[model samples]
Target: MHNHGAVGLPLGFTLLRLILLGAVTVVAGWALVRPFVPAASGLLTRRVVTGFAGIGGVVVLLIAEATWMPSLAAVALIGLLAVPPALRGARPVLGKLVVAAAVLVTAAAGAWFSGPPSSFAYITLMAAFVGVSWLALCPPTAMVRVVGAALGVTLLAGLGQVTIAGQLTTPATGDPLLTRVALGPSPVDVLVVPHMPGWNIVHTTDTPLSVGNAPNALVPALPRDGTTGRWALVWLPEGRGELWLDRAGTRTTVPVDPGKVAWTGPDVRGPEGPDYASAVLAAKLTGKRGDLPWPALTDADAEALRGQVAAIGGPFTVLTDDSRRAAEAAEVVREEAARRGYAVTPGTSEVLVLGGTPPSGARHHLAPWLVPPDLTTPEARRYARTLSAAFPGAAPSRSGLAAWAG
Candidate 1:
């Protein structure tokens, strides 16, 4: 599955988060500056400082409850707003209280959101360290000169815990966990001729199957033996093209000859065989020969086609002749389109006709190939029978029905 990136937060929440972050940064800068400035400077009165501290405390609580990572824009804004206050300084008893209260509030918030950091003993130790440091900084202590040294160790420890937790929990940038492609026999054989070195073909005993990152380029499971652990059962276009295998965010490309890869059936050989009727059907459905399209109507292809039609945002119609195969193919197309919110209205200007003459004013057409009488191979006959069973109606031609085996 593809990672399309994170969804944006709502505008009101984002604005509120920014406001809270700004308040926290300002209050933090003031507290950092408070240790050096003199009282005679009169930069801030105790009354005003206490009021701002209260506001900052409320904002911190809100931020803790929300628990959102600050965006780059918010960080930049905070940095710019912090410069002036950080440069200025003051030494006030109330300033120490403000900083200590902020720290305690933050710790309380962390405990409420995340479970308590480590254990009860660790928590008690941290609290003791904080209390000792606060006592060293307060006016009653002779250790005021050594307050910075006391807090520095505790600050470093907290930073270490944050850094380690972030590293352990977060995946490296641009590196995502990939779902490994299952190894074993599949409906269509995919020949891997590595264009680069350092690649080895491996096998697994996993059941069912996984399409990995190339869901649209292959069919699911169909019984085929003798290819269990050697060859990967994937389908590519019939020619020399690049085949990519992605594992652990690294992609390995290999050149392949798709003509050598065989489909599952008695009469159906590889794409090079004459009776490879599946390829013919895929070509008709996708309007592309021997490229990307598999020899079947895969779910990926259906969804892709639906997305394309939905993107157009216009009305269209699906038409088919009296032939059973043509009607079956048309129904498949109509159903897929409908699933993507594309309605099939009658007499729409855009019409997709299968094995039938386009009605008047029709703009789009997908005519099927008429099977020649001499082209009566076992594979072709099998396709005909499958079509007849899908839609039982008056047959179209004497030679055969439209090919719709997939």
Candidate 2:
């Protein structure tokens, strides 16, 4: 028997989330309506009211994404609409001010208990704060108003955090298991077996895995067989002290023999040397048969890559920069691979970096170690400094770059 583990929110939490979201939505709706409430001889004419209503409706939609800019805009618009009625003949009473402050404090405490504020909840709370402020500035209201305000404040406390926590805590359904494949070479294959579906196994390494670098390092896991799922294999490079695999947040070590696989091919060099070797090995693992091409030999190189794709017998991507030469090189490889009867697309993965712009994208099979471009230019260095000051500890690195792409 296999345990897939808990996969989604608990039934009670799911109900609670729905209820809280619904209450917040109700408060937002009230706030939206409160601004349009017609007053005798007020600044708002029918046409003006309709126009503001239409605009506010759109603002509400934008606040669903709850990005900072849109959220601020929504708050400003709500305040503008609420000001006239809230201010008319309203006295600055100490009791109302105290109540408003208390409501806000209670709402904030609720939100804190729910967890860290997500954008959606934060924005919702902001809008609610505006509404509560408007209420405080207005004349004393009825029992119904008191009840509504209390409920709104209560809902605000739990609204954003519960949803954020639920999303963060949800576990991936599929688990990965590794098995060693001791075939004829120094870089042997290790099969990655997925216990469930929807597993796009991308991150693997030959060293101890960390949250930072696991996504960037190359693992010996080459897909030797054309098949996926149960038949998938990872080619481990020879003489690596250890092999590490990471999926989602889980990490594991796969045991391997350190024996070297003899290489009879022409010597390849440069930063792209590992890329070339990995591409060829990947192709061979997928049962592709072709003559090895020398990297220095352009025609032979294209043919060799073509053979690799032909062996793999599936979709492939060519990672290139914005430069003309890089684009042309990518085109050459794409055309060559396509000629071998497989679809080859432009953009990262099965990567061959010619020059300019670091290789990135989901399908990249090799770790691309890169020097920060900020090291070379004054303007770039200044920008990097500014970014570091703003984000702190987020200075650019290969792993950070890959995670950024993701």
Candidate 3:
């Protein structure tokens, strides 16, 4: 994950601050509320709003997947709020005492058994703390006010976990997995969407950019026939190391140690189908590819790139997510690749899998945006920094997200 923003503030520290602020707020609220509960008798009293509050709380608890403790606490608070005022007042002192003790026990149990996953432990624990604060704040007469806020905040904790779980399954906008692509927030990480005649910048605000989801992607306008263009999927399996991208349809085999670029053949399907096409295009790279790495570029190299792409011939699209400028630069790469004898087909993405570190003979390292994951150097980092400054985005906020869109 990328850290820091356009102004160079550490992203990680920002998240930590948010967590701390939530904790402080809950603690402060609890301290303020606890003093008003004069006696245990107050716990047994009910107010006018209890019925509606109890019904809502019970419904939410039943429908939600909150762990036992938050659920238990929410239910108890609702019940306390809903009971008839006289009936609650008539309850024996010992009975109220037992219920209070049970709640305390529930709190302890929640602390022990229902903690957040380690990856997001700090945020999860803060939610629990906030719920405990609510426990203290739920005065009998204002049951709806306090309990409602508490349950709402605590439910966010569960949502956080769900978001984390969804990370693996969510499909990026461009479906990088299919095209053998990578993504990050910075310009160095984002591919420029070659510009067309009437292109305009899409996302003007600086929300930390995920290249895969960035609105500026080289999305070819679908043809009138609606058929996906011909795609050349190729992968060079790492020496003696192989991974499988697909196990369905015609591509069920996994290579243990692939020796050369394995072509899945020319595919002509939209993003909707299974990985049968993508798997053919996939490569299992242990190290790097090609003899010489291209120098990473900073800022827009539009004119220079155009000169370079002049050799590659007409009507080509860039392999990028940037909706604004990917088309502009694709010709540079297209021409060069064609001049170099790599296949250049119309309406087809020409992909090459380059892995492993460059040999000592390599002189020019490619731009950070072009380099595959296995090959990143000091020069690449420098280029990335420069590119980021040129196209800055706001720090990302991934506190809550959901799954599934392919």
lDDT of 3 by residue, 265-284 (tens): 22222221112221111110
lDDT of 2 by residue, 194-306 (tens): 21222222222222223111234533333212112121123334321223444333443332222232233322222233323322333223333212232332454455545
Alpha-carbon TM-score of each model against the true structure:
0.25, 0.24, 0.28
Q: Who is ahead in TM-score, 1 or 2?
A: 1
122-164: candidate 1 lDDT, tens digit per residue: 2322332333323322343334424533433433353344233
lDDT of each: 0.35, 0.37, 0.30
lDDT of 2 at 60: 36
Which prediction has the highest TM-score against the true structure? Answer: 3
Question: For each candidate, how many residue pairs have backbone atoms clashing (under 3 Å)?
Answer: 3, 11, 33
Candidate closer to the true structure by lDDT (higher is better), 2 or 3: 2
Q: Give the TM-score of candidate 2.
A: 0.24
